[model samples]
Target: MRTILAAGALALALGASGIAFAEPVKVGMITTLSGGGAGLGVDARDGFMLAIKLSGSKDIEVVTEDDAMKPELAVQIADKMIQSDKVDVLTGIIWSNLAMAVVPNAVAQGKFYLSVNAGPSPLAGAKCDKNYFNVAYQNDNFHEAAGNYAQTEGIKKMFILAPNYPAGTDSLNGFKRYYKGELVGEVYTKLGQTDYAAEIAQIRASGADSVFFFLPGGMGIAFMKQYAQSGVGIPVMGPGFSFSQDVLAAIGDAALGAKNTASWSPDLDNPKNKEFVEAFKTEYNRLPSIYAAQAFDTGTLLAAAAAKADVKDADAFRAALAAAEFDSVRGKFKFNTNHHPIQDFYVREVVKNDEGVLTNKIVATSFTDHTDAYAAECKL
Candidate 1:
């Protein structure tokens, strides 16, 4: 367990009298930090800690652990964090399967789970809980945006593939929800798969005009590199995870001109986003990824809620969190009935920046003030 120290120019007072609380708010973060998906988890941790540091609240103490991309390990870490650490809030999970193993248990045990990423459909639908909130996005939101983009572009037959995990399955389902096109092929690869020789052969034979995939982290890096080498001429696209800042350079020109969808971008014209991007780059000496942005938003939202209500008061704190009164990096951010984000999703094309670094630029807005399809099914 590591304690993150707060240091920044921004000052935040926790109580109504503008003073720090007697007892600190304890946060437990269980995420992948040493595996194929380590990059995503590392960025999430850095971005979340950065936001907490910038909030300048000495009352927030975070204890973190590496889950190593295993469900059992994540469950063990979550139990330790909640029982031994006595954490007030649980956050910072990157994968949906791990979240499934931890969130319901943590929330049911009276710990608030402010999800930084991995908003599984079950959590957002009939099984919704008052103590669990997803500050990032629903697992399907980004893929749905990509589907809308493909529909607008008049894509006829699309070949899509994803890892055979909760998030991966949600990705393809979301795409199919909004993509008014015939599916040439749909393949489910192994989670954390590194090779694409077999998938590439299938894609080539499918004769699809375009391809969509949901391989993230090192898997994306490996797949894009192998896909490039395969010499298959089909245009490829996916959600922002595949082309995030952490993996873009590794993907190199393979991701160039590929369109992806996201809720927030570094270039988003908002004061909070501008400050966050500058602070992230200055503090970390590198650009932040979509995972980072979501985690940062989670931290900032918690800070805002902490300012209004004490973590000990469940009802007040839940109301404060649901209010979502913080300025988000993505403009016009709000929470739906299901505790998922209702915001704009944009289609961004991968392009080389003026500094010759591969990055994304918003090409079109796919959905504005969009709520997840499952929100209506949520009773809460």
Candidate 2:
């Protein structure tokens, strides 16, 4: 009878200490792991895994898959995660098109979708779902900041270019929303087009005071190299996607002094950011890009939310996620009504580091406490 009583007491003590056994939380990450955009997804996945490792949480099981940057493939993977694997959370899509294809459907099926990148406008607006959360900024945030910076710099006639896709359109529209300058020319190139000789020729003839382009990944590296060789001599401006750490080495001196906008940077002044940068560099032997920072924050956010509520209780888990008690590497982290981040955007310039490696340095703040334009349209 004493042994039974002692065992009961020990069990009660463990329960009261919040150390009761719980089922492992299952997570599914689908990102572009191959092809032109692989670098971005690789960084995101590395950062996320690093956070999970640092947390030392044995109760979290992550399943990662490569989407190859295909929207249909991403959709299929989302279905598998939801129906077959029964993952509680889904995250890590690098492209807007892929996110659009997977996020809404997955969320509608009662799975929480935390976006580490690719915050398409539709998801941030009328189609917003309670189960969807964007750890990254809205798709337009950085582009809008670029526009504001262009206006501040007194750029009278700016030429703009982007790939012909949903994100490309959003990027150009975001720039136009705040630029308030005459557009000398606007061009939409085919996605993944390598040669920019034709585009450079047009820019040279457009008589524009400055040029802004939204070609990310390998496309950005190709364009910068060609543009420099073309000798257009026009100052280049863009969002951070085109100038991130993952691609800067490839872009080389061609991107030097180029200014871009972003919500997070490796040099951001905050305790969380400092730790993240140091740890990321040590683990990956590379600087963490905005994509990586967002992914890392996603992991931290999930760990915090999971601690507060069990994944089996959807409502409770959602509430904990909405509470957002995690320390963000971006410094000020909060979700707007649409589940999109409301944060500051800063202009960054490409500069050579002490080791002569190309990287971005924060130059100025472009927007403060900025929320997405589509938040008003979201009924949720």
RMSD of each: 6.0, 1.9
| Alpha-carbon runs more than 4 Å astray in model 1 | 1-18
Top of the candidates by TM-score: 2
Q: How do all models score by TM-score?
A: 0.93, 0.96
Can you write out model 2's per-residue Cα lDDT over 1-380, one digit (the tens) per residue?
99999999998888777725566789999998998788999999998998888777778899999999999999999899888899999999988889988988888889999999989998899999999999998999899999999999889999999999889999999999999989999999999899999999999999999999999988999999999999899999999999999989888898999999999888889999999999999998988988899999999999888887889989999999988999999998898988898889999999998889888899999999999999999998
Backbone collisions counted per model = 0, 0
Q: Which ten residues in a row have the lowest lDDT in candidate 2?
A: 15-24
> Can you write out model 1's per-residue Cα lDDT over 267-294, one digit (the tens) per residue?
8889999999999989998888999999
Q: Please give the CA lDDT of all the candidate structures.
A: 0.90, 0.92
- Estimate candidate 1's alpha-carbon lDDT, on a 0 to 1 scale: 0.90
